[model samples]
Target: MVGLTYKILPNLTAYGGYSEANRAPTPLELNCSSPTRPCILASTLISDPPLQQVASHTIETGVRGNLAIPAGGTIDWKAGLYRTSSTNDIIQLASLVLGTGYFTNVPETLRQGVEAHASLSIGAFSAYINYAYVDATYQFSGTLSSPFNPYADANGNIFVHPGDHIPGIPRQQLKVGGDYAFTPEFKAGFDVLIVGSQYYVGDDSNQNPQLPMYWVANLHASYQITNNVQIFGLINNLFNNHYATYGTFFDQTTDAQFAGNPVNFVSDPRTITPAQPIAFYGGVKVTF
Candidate 1:
C-alpha cells in the first residue's frame, strides 16, 4: 500500500492512494464448490477442488477543505472517488436443489464509487450530510445455476455477461442529520436515511425487477436532571415506512408440496426480509 498528499491551499488539501489485498477462501466456500452435488451446509459435507485466493487492487483520490465564517461558524467538506478490481472473486449461486446454493470463483469483478460529506457547526447547533454512489459489476462472462430464478434456462442455469450489476448492493445512499441544544442540560437530534434500489440476491443476471427504494427518519432527545441522573428517549422509523433491506428468489410451490398443502397454487419466486417498523424507546441513566 502507498499514499500521497499535497497541500493545495492554506485550508485545502488533495490526497490519493493505491492498495492491494488478498483473501483466502473459507472452509465453507472451499467445501461447497460443486454445482452438481449441492451441500446443505454442515449437514452435507463433501470433498471439492481447491479455490484460488482472491486478489484485488484499489485506487482512490480525493480532496478536502475547511472554511471559517466571519459570523462565528465553520464548514468542513470532502469528496472522493475510488475503484477496485478483483480476480478470482468468489460468488454464491443457487443450485438445482431447493433452499441450497454453491460458491464459485469468477474470473474478474469490479467496484467503483464516489463519495462526499459535509458538515456545519454554529454554537449549539450542528448539522452534517453524506452521499455515496456505487457501481459494482461483473468483469467476466460465465453461466451460474439458479434453478429458482424465473428466467433460468432449461438446464437451470443463467448466462451472465460482463457489465451486469451485482446483486444486493445499492447504487446510491444519502444521510442527513443535525443536533440542537435547547439549554445547557437538554439536547435533541434528528436524522434521515435514504437508500436506492438494487437487484435481488439471486438476480445476478439482472433479469428481474429491482427492490424499490426507501427512506427512514429517526428522532432522539436527552435531558440531564442532575449531576448523577439523566433521561433519554428515541423514536425510530418515525413515519412507519414499509421497506425490505434484502430480497432473494425461492420456490413457494415446492414448500407447499412439502407441507402437504393443496398443489393448486400460484408460484411467486420473490422472497424478502422486511425492515423494522416504527418504534419508541426511553430510559433513565444514573451515575454513582
Candidate 2:
C-alpha cells in the first residue's frame, strides 16, 4: 500500500492511496471440495483440489478538514471513495445435502463505495453523523456447481452472471449520535445505526425476498466516583428491535425426514440467525 497527502488550506487536507493484497485459503476451505464424500459441517477433514489465493487491488481518495465555529467550537468532516477488484475470491456454496457446503473460488469480484462523516462539538456537548454506500458484485461470467442452486432449471445447471450482488452484504449503512457532559464527573450518550437489506446466499438471481432493513439505538452513561474510580453502563438495542444479520436457504429434508411421514412433510427452507435482543451491562473501573 502507498499513500500521499497534501494540505489544501490552514485546516483542510486531501489524501489518496493505493494498495494490493492477497490471502490464502484456510485449511478448512482448502480440504472440503468433494461432492461424492462430503465432510460433515464443522468437521475436521482434508481433501484435494487445493484452492487459489485471493488477490485484490484497490484505490482510494478522500478529503478531510475542520472549521472553527463562533462559540469557540469546531466542526470536523471527512469524505472518501474507494474501489477494489479481487480475483479468485473464495466463496461458500450451499450443498445439496442439509447443513453442508464447500468453499470455492470465484473468477473475479468488485466493490466500490463512498463514505462520509462529520462531527460538531460545542462546549460540553457534541454530535456526529456518518453514512456509507457500497456496490459489491460479481464481475465474472461462468457456471458454478452447487447443491443449493436456486437458478437451476430442469436440467440442474448453475450459472452466475456478471453484476450479481454478493449475498449477505448490505449496500448501505448510516449512523448518528451525540453526547453531553452534564458535569466533570458525569456523561451520557446515544447512537443509532441503520443497515440496508441484502440478498440471501444461493439467491444470486435475487429471486427470493431480500432481508428487511433495520435500525438499532443504544444508550450509555458514565460517572466518576473518584479520581481513581469510575462506573459505566450501557443499554444495547434499546427498543428491543428484532432483526437478522445473516440468512440463507437450504434443504432441511435430511435432518427432518427421519421423524415421520418424511415423504409427505415439507420443511421450511430458509435458515436465519437472529441478532441479539435488548441487553444491558454495567461495570466499574479503578486506576491506581
Q: Write the per-residue lDDT of candidate 2 for residues 1-288, one digit (tens) a residue.
A: 999999999899999999999999888878886654455765647665888999999999999999999888999999999999999999877655556767788899999999999999999999999999999999988765545545555543466789988888899999999999999999999999999999877776566788888999999999999999999999999999999988877655655566754663445566778999999999999999
Backbone clashes per model, in order?
A: 0, 0
Compose the digit string of candidate 1's lDDT tens values, residues 54-158: 999999999999999766999999999999999999998888888787888999999999999999998999999999999999997888787878998999888
Per-residue error (Å), model 1, residue 170: 0.7
Name the regions of candidate 1 deviating beyond 4 angstroms: 36-47, 224-230, 261-264, 284-288
TM-score of each: 0.91, 0.89
Q: Which regions in candidate 2 have their CA more than 4 angstroms from the true location?
A: 33-43, 153-157, 252-255, 263-268, 286-288
Instruction: Pull out the clashing pairs in model 2.
Output: none
**Model 1: how far is 141 from its true place, Å?**
0.8
Return model 1's CA RMSD, one decimal: 2.4
